[model samples]
Target: MSLGEAFRTAVYKEPVMVWSLMIYGVGISYAAFVKPSMIEPHSKDLPSAPPSLKEVMAGIQAKLNNK
Candidate 1:
């Protein structure tokens, strides 16, 4: 059979396996070659670290006073 016919038969016989392999291949290629940026805690766009213990107490007290 010709190349197209061979490919059609393969797909017809195991469509699920073929599609799963195709998805896995694309995922692996993306992870290996895309080089996605790493997120840094110190990035300017992110808010600073967690509030201090003192700051938390101050906020609680302010909320109580407001009520």
Candidate 2:
């Protein structure tokens, strides 16, 4: 069988394949229609040391998050 015939036969044989293909197609189409902007880089937006930890941390050194 030709490549096109093989693909058509496989797609018809597997019901899950058909449903999966439809779901994937719809997801790609929705993302294409609602393209979103990218986020800013982490390093670029990193905050500097707070000038006055008094108001923010009650005049104490900020503890590390240790994530």
Q: What lDDT would candidate 1 get against the real structure?
A: 0.83
Superposed by TM-score, candidate 2 places the C-alpha of residue 29 at a distance from the truth, in angstroms, of 0.5
Report the lDDT tens digits of candidate 1 across residue range 1-67. 9999988888998798899989999999877766454444337677668889999999999999999
The most accurate candidate by TM-score is 1
Q: What is the C-alpha lDDT of each candidate?
A: 0.83, 0.70
Measured over all alpha carbons after superposition, the RMSD of each candidate to the real structure, in angstroms, is 5.8, 8.5
TM-score of 2: 0.43
Global CA lDDT computed for model 2: 0.70
Clashes of each: 0, 1
What candidate 2 gets wrong by more than 4 Å, as runs, is 35-67
Q: Which residue pairs show backbone clashes in model 2?
A: 54-59
